[model samples]
Target chain A: MIRNLQVAPDHYLLELRLPAEFPCPEPGQFMMVRLRGRDEPFLSRPFSVHNFRMHRGSVSLEILYRVVGKGTLLFSRQSKGTILGILGPLGRPFRISSICPTVVLLSGGIGVAPLAYLAHRCRGRNAGGKRTSIIVYAGARNAQSIVGIKHFEAVDLRICTDDGSRGFHGPVTALFERDLCSYDPEKTMIYACGPPAMIGSLARILEATSFSCQVSMEERMACGVGACLGCVTAVKDNGGRIRYERVCREGPVFDIRDLAGLKTDPC
Target chain B: MNASGTFGFGEEFAPFVDLNELGALVVKGLSWEPRQGNPPPRIIETVGGMLNAIGLENPGARAFIEEKLPFLRQYDVAVIANIFGETLDEYPRVAEALSRAGGIKAIEVNISCPNVKKGGIAFGADPDIAAEVTRQVKTATDMPVIVKLTPNVADITDVARSVEAAGADAVSLINTLTGMAIDVESRTPQIQNVTGGLSGPAIRPVALRMVWQTVKRVSIPVIGVGGIMRAEDALEFLIAGAKAVQIGTANFVNPQITLEVIAGIEGYLIRHRMDDIRDLIGSLIEPDSLEHPHEP
Candidate 1:
């Protein structure tokens, strides 16, 4: 069961008590949720792993979400201590090894959910003298949309709002594009999540610069467990038959290079 | 309990029908997080059935637990948790979570989801994994587990027997086969998910066949789903060896179908002077065997 805890008005962070000794969800991994209340329109909604904590008997998942539809709207109205029905650790998680030292986490809007977890995972893994610098480039429609970065200590966070209300104007891409030119493409692996177009648009720019990035794709899924194939992304396999990729099963997290024809340019 | 993907669990249908009056209300599929589901134009209408690629857009298991279940508790229906996963491990983790739920009664393991990019077919299409998933869930929790089978498999019977052997309390069928509708004029698939599952009258015959095959192979009661529209349609399943029936596509057309079927069953019982609804179950006869197979 997940405990629906309110964060800010219209924003909520859901927490679930997973069984203890279960496998830890990877950084970019995600879960699916169904909001309570009769007024909610959508039956189920998906969110990336915000973070997790292991206890003596159970592991818990923390996911942050904003009410956008019938699902979130109802969720936001929920008071703390409200319980919800949940399914999770559903999709594939981002792959991280001890060797990948310098990491860049990117997001558009609330795409920061998994990226925040990624930063936490990376920070936890950084050993003596390894100095895994975490660079965050978050894009939002406005400054109010920024999330979770105020508390992160080790990671350097940059904000880009479309309206130029705060921080850098233009897009996160401007910041990301700037870093891409100066950063060591080989040592640093890019972990990204959010809406498809933002990821897709940035993917195009990344392709032009030969920067390797791993992307988490978003699809409206019915069964986040993969059998529904409702959350599918097109990918040109090695032989190049654009087949349907079930985001719930294979990934919400996938290798950007592997998505092939679904991504623009040589990517 | 209903299956995932085909129906958005019990949420959408509850509006038009009294959810608690039904036996159990199974909700939609759960992942680890919230999903946006498929792209635009997710649903497409056909002659008798509808094809959808609405991808399992859910709020992940955590969200469902935190935000969804409380609302479901408002209704008096037994909440059946419909969980899906990529591999054997996914089922147990979800089941364990659902086990802790306050109002949930049973867990419906969705063995028939066709939406995920990978790890989906490996479990649903394979008898070993299907059973393995059942075993895993049964071991993880004390709740009754129902393994919902997909119609896309080569041998639905083999999977049914496997789940039964693996200690599943009950099993359900048939989940929709992977399907698609193309917008020929636009030269693209009509559904955003590219290929969605096929449900409704188009798949009734297939569902009936699978249900017949499954019940014959396993003693566990089979809950038949797919293309169930009316009480007679529900009756067809009851006669075909189903102990109960799940109304899937019909909910979209008529949310009251489940109640209608329940009323229809009562009417049938009263009209025939049959004492119990069980008397109407497993009425399939092949002439060679006039005796009831399940009779004590």
Candidate 2:
């Protein structure tokens, strides 16, 4: 552990010095963390890599989390130099389809962690050398819950809080929906990560559109690897049959249309 | 040894674990047909353990042989195939299929999966049915048979002894305890299946007591399972007469746990000045037999 800083109420930004030989994690990939030698919380908790940097020839990882349960509470109390058990870079990364002209990054509360990393990747030009415009819509329950905005270098950054203490009033999804009129479906791509309700709202808004999108999901997991067969999310197979896929392996990021909840035909 | 379901066909942990270091790799319960298993919210973490209702989802016997078994064959570990059925007759068929595959060293009959409706715990809960399943599998294959017993029964020893009598070469006890947890705020069950099999450190003491009981009742070799996280935990089972120990939930926490446990057991032997592991097996000293209580 390098730094453990409380960025907001009930939220923290933990920095860890990754092993020199550790592989670089893609933006949407995650790490499973547990306090070294602690047994109260038996299983490790999965956290998306908020941001990472090359520090003194080694990788430095940042994890943004909220104190929602026993595991996060324990993580909040730890100080510098406390060794931890970390299982890395697991799950498939977000695939940027084709040479898109614009990328929309959406998030709610601590969900903005991974999107910040995505935004960092979006800052540069695409394979065709066409400059890609980046836009981020981040939201939270209140202003105190809004964080990680400074880490993003997006061309446009919109913030929304439930209590109206931040940029826009009401939900971030509402702000994104209001701004959706100007985006060209052929040139734009959307990526989201947030609370289930927020994601659900965004999914409903994009259900009938041709806009390409991917959303990251969260679940309580025993093993961050696929072996446990735990942490599964409902999704439609190629045959349109609803089947469970491991969130840890198959994806933490999936196309909006593939999720079973958004399937048009009810089985 | 890794308990079934906790270790997937052995390929998933290859990056972090050396499969050859394990005593045996027990694959997840394979049925006659590919099963999708349970729905969402299949697993939930409790105080010290987890409740899972994965419902024995696997790529049937044939698929396992064609796809997963080949990957496992690359590793130099003994592969124990754990098979189950929804009906009584399916047991022999699954066992016969795996036996024909040639790589599997033993067949561990899983008549104790609590998540399923019909053939799992139903057969294990009754001694006669457990014995019948064992007898049928033994008749169908030339491989050694090990029947896994459930702790969700009135008496695990009765099931153990019955299976032993039915020609089981070995017995592994005890499978997870049937358990459930509720989300008080949501006013609903934490697991989608309502009740799941609980495995972890919380069930260690109960599992230890049951393994000790079953060891005394059965003449065959007994393998202790359930919530064995550390070498000390495995040693407890060994001292209680378990010939082998299987680590389940701990594998989820650390993939290299089995290697650490193997090293820890060796360290214990060296510290105690014991030349052989058999010296520790069934070494439990009763209170009345304690000659040097303060010598340690």
Candidate 3:
């Protein structure tokens, strides 16, 4: 581990030195992390790559997290020299296409980590030199909860707070809805990751407008690899039949239309 | 052995550890038809363990034979297919399907899964029911059948002896103990199924005790499984008369645990100047049997 920085109240940005040979993780892909040699917390927790960068023969990635539970609480207390176990670059990554020249990254609170990486990657590739326009809509409980927006260097950043203590005085969904008419739905793609409630609200809005969107889901996972089927999400096949697909395998990122029943209570 | 349910088809751990190093790769519990399993939150972590109500979800027997079995055929590890059923009739059919698949070295009958509503622990909790399921599965396949027994019973040995009487080649025990956790704020159960099977280091002591008792009762080989996270844990079971040990929840903690455990056991044998693992198996020296019990 290289650095563990407290970026905000109860939130942190953990930087770890990666082997140069490590496979670079795509924005939406995640890694399972746990305290090395500790058996009390039997399973590793999954975290999306907050930021991935290389500089002067060194490669490191930053993971953004909040101390919400025992696993994250213990992770927050680790020092710079603590060695942690990690299983990486697992699950399907967000697929960016040329058809959608305009990409909208929608995130809620700490869910902004992967979206920040998505924006950074798109700007780096210049969307394969197609002049892609990038926009980010970050929502949180208050100003203190919003995080990881600084890495979104060259994109349009919009912030909203539920408590009306930040940029826009409402949920991020409402702000995005008001500006929905400005972009052409045919050329725009929306990517979202957040609390289930926020995603539910966005799903409702997108259903009415019929814009193409994909959602990154979070589930309590035992094995980040596909071995344990502990992290499955409800989804509809092409036949519209509902089945559980491993979020750690087929997704953490899935097209909104493929979700079964659009139920807010993720199983 | 990578315990059933914790290890997928063994393909997931291929990148981290060589499959040839494992004693056997026990795939997830397979049903005649694909089961969606219980609703979530199906899993929750406790102090030193976790409760899971996965309810035996899988791609079904046909899917395993057609899609999953091919990937496992490349490996040199012994493949043990763990089969279960919602009904007694489903048992033989699924066992026959896997047996016909050709690559399977053995079949592990799962009558002990605690999460399901019927045909899992229900069959396992009763000696007669467990024996019936074991007999049916055994008759359907020419391969060796090892019956997995549940811990959520008055006496685990009753079920073990029953299965042995009915022609089980070996027996693996104990499956997760029935447990539940509640969220104080919501006043709701942490598991969607109200109760789940508890596994990990928390259940190791109880599991080891059961294995010792069952080992004494059944003449057939006894395979110990339940929260075996390290080499010492595996050795403890072997000393208690278990022929072999299976790694369960520890695979979730570390994918390379099987290799580590295999190496650790070898290292201990070398240090003790033992030539064979059979000398270590069931080699426990009771205090009363020793001349000076207190002397180390």
Task: Give the alpha carbon lDDT tens digit for every residue of B95-131 in model 1.
Answer: 8987897778988888777766655556888888888
Looking at candidate 2 chain B, the ten consecutive residues that score lowest on lDDT are B287-296
Q: For residues B157-275, write the lDDT of model 3, one tens digit per residue.
A: 99999999999999999999999999998899988898999999999999999999998899999999989999999999999989989998999989999999999999999999999
Rank ordering of all candidates by TM-score, starting from the highest = 3, 2, 1
User: Each candidate: what lDDT?
Assistant: 0.73, 0.89, 0.89
lDDT comparing candidate 2 with the true structure:
0.89
- The candidate with the higher lDDT, 1 or 3, is 3
Q: Which candidate has the top score in TM-score? A: 3
Give the lDDT of residue A231 in candidate 2: 86
> What does candidate 2 score on TM?
0.95
Off by over 4 Å in 2: A262-267, B289-296
Q: What DockQ results for candidate 3?
A: 0.73
Q: TM-scores for all candidates?
A: 0.54, 0.95, 0.96
Say which prediction, candidate 2 or candidate 3, comes out ahead on DockQ. Answer: 3
lDDT of 2 by residue, A1-267 (tens): 998999989999999998887889998999999876656887999999999888688889999999988889999999999998899989898887567778999898888999998888778767335788888888888887788887886469888988999899988889988999889888888999887777778778887888889999888788888899988898997898988888999889988778886423211
lDDT string, candidate 2, B119-230, tens digits: 9999999999999999999999999999999998888999998999999999998888999999898999999999999999999999999988888888899999979889
User: Interface Cα RMSD per model, in Å?
Assistant: 8.9, 1.0, 1.0
Q: Which ten residues in a row have the lowest lDDT in candidate 2 chain A?
A: A258-267
